[model samples]
Target: MAAGCQGCRTAQHQFAIAMAFQPIVDVETGLPFAYEALVRGEDGEGAADVIARVTPENRYAFDQQCRVAAIEGAVAAGILDTSARLSINFLPNAVYSPVACIQLTLQTSKATGLPVDRLIFEFTENEQMADTSHVKNIVDSYRKMGFGTAIDDFGAGHAGLGLLAAFQTDYIKLDMELIRGLDTSMPRRMIVEGVLRIAKSLDITVIAEGIETLGEYDVLRGMGVRYMQGYLLARPGFKTLPPIALPGELYAAVA
Candidate 1:
């Protein structure tokens, strides 16, 4: 193993995983909203570096540890309750072992006494589905268990609309790159509009990610985007979120 990998392995086993809460706000109401738990490795190594050292051979282990740590940390900190939904990012490869992931998550919830329905699993756009049948099966199992699944970076990957049509996703998060500069780009606006239309037809909720300015928020709001996440609302940090209210007008207009 490379020095970095060797060092990371030792650190990974002993490292404390900390949870940071990033508020997912209702685009129209502009209020504090759902909290997505961001995981960080706390062993004097940056998270990016730690993730890089995680190989396909050990990806499942790495991700499971992170998930468990995030849940435990959140519950211990009193950030998770019956009313609060906890969103956690899961790599595509992790879904290959979906049963294990689901089991671990459910076990955490049971141990913490938090409802499984309040946990949201967010998968990135780059995850390749080696077996669609297996992916669907895993999704179905989680749904049966009352957990929600979200596809992250919806527009930037190979899956795009096809994945939405194929998988049963509760939420589709638009890529930040797509949301950036959307106010000035008609093409971008049109693409987002198309996504919103598709999502509505499928009954899937859409969330715009990486909004840094009111201009972007206003443009998305006008485009019928109902949920948003970006620096403008709140950055990802360790603080617990305050109460969040979804904008009634935005939902009405979208409806």
Candidate 2:
């Protein structure tokens, strides 16, 4: 077997934290929307770099810190509110630390007066979750506390379906790769349709990610996608997002 990669635990522990906010728009209405907090290492390094340098023992703590920083920064900047949701990413392992992180996040929310319902915890499909039972328990706990949960990059891998079945996610984000050429590709269209069908059956909201082109947007809208995010909508940056508007025809058709 290949040797296990190590070092990320230490590096992640020492990595500085930064936040990049992306606006989530309602595809039908197109307005200055809720913010999705993106995390980056302030040490001039990416999350992957930090993950590559740390040991597994400390990885969850480091991940929790990054997540807390994102929420704290957003609240401090007055960009987040009780009316608008704040989405923060959480590594699968960090789910086990929900009690601690949730306490901190709740405290931040209390200080900012942002409602617990407006806080969304996002989990990416990139990492394998070792204890899904524990993860589900933690996720349920957060939901009971009025927080929403989402699974990012849905339909990107084998575990995506499992996650959907296991967690009562409030939102399911479609992977950008599956959306890039959706208008022209039957395969991509089929995949998105299938995901939508499942999401609808589960009463979960669907958000199509990486909608950078009109063609992509049009196709997703036709597919009944309700929410969207990407450069075409708004890039991840420090600046506040301007209100977005749908193409006139799109509004007329939906209206």
Candidate 3:
């Protein structure tokens, strides 16, 4: 970050925060594919309370802080000891020059002994963007730099197909609404299946989030979704990595 941004970050330091990590599971291995770093307050408050600290004037600093915080926090929490990647949510709008802004992140990872390849930057599709090409540029730059990128809350927001049609990412997480009660809803199943076909053709991995029931998990796995994240696996652990376990009934059935 530049001196001006450093000043801004220093001024905004009161945004005292913590990170919570929830693993995204891979069904085939039944291990965490990656852990997503969720922003929380220092006292264990929710993300909203911390996110509200961000303003137009301080957005750049806030975004920069989040990146460094996620990297440092994950490393402090033992992410470097595992093969699973560290996924951090980012605000694309705050990024002026992807390459320039990423210098700090690269430095932080290098200092922390965390491989750059083990980092994933995920952005919510619901986040409004004035320039779609800028976001695509960020993705392309991240890809060239060996960083993974993903679209979070994929189907429930604006520019879903539009963004996919424009640039490709490493992963896209399906919105929970589509995954909710999926087994019994033909429309939901059909939609998810269509997305799977598209994702397959694009060579993009699909991660279904908000899976809370066995029926939902069964239908998704049957539909061939191997990557998933939700309460069914584990919840986010503030400043820690939560353990993940698949439903025992599944193993019993296999037995």
Predicted structure with the largest TM-score when compared to the true one: 3
Ranking by lDDT: 3, 2, 1
- Per-model TM-score versus the true fold: 0.82, 0.83, 0.93
Query: How high a TM-score does candidate 1 get?
Result: 0.82
Q: lDDT value for candidate 1? A: 0.71
Q: How do the residues 166-206 of candidate 1 rate in per-residue lDDT, one tens digit apiece?
A: 78688889999899998888999989999888888889899
Q: Report lDDT per candidate.
A: 0.71, 0.72, 0.88
Score residue 211 of candidate 2 by CA lDDT. Answer: 87
lDDT of 2: 0.72
The residue pairs found clashing in candidate 1 are 32-244
Among residues 3 or more apart in sequence or in different chains, the pairs in candidate 3 whose N, CA or C atoms overlap within 3 Å are none
lDDT of 3: 0.88
For 106-187, candidate 3 gives per-residue lDDT tens digits of 8889999999999999999999877999999999999999999999999988887988999999999999999999989999
Scanning candidate 3 in windows of ten residues, the lowest lDDT window is 3-12
Q: Which regions of candidate 2 deviate over 4 angstroms?
A: 1-13, 43-54, 80-82, 239-255
Off by over 4 Å in 1: 1-16, 28-32, 43-46, 95-97, 239-255
Q: For model 3, what is the error of residue 59's alpha carbon versus the real structure, in angstroms, after optimal superposition?
A: 1.4
lDDT by residue (1-255, candidate 2, tens digit) is: 011122222223455667767878876676544778776566435556655755576565566576667777777766653255788887766444555445556665787667777788888775677777877887788788888888888878558788777776888889999999899999999989998998899999998888877789889888888789988777776523334445664446556
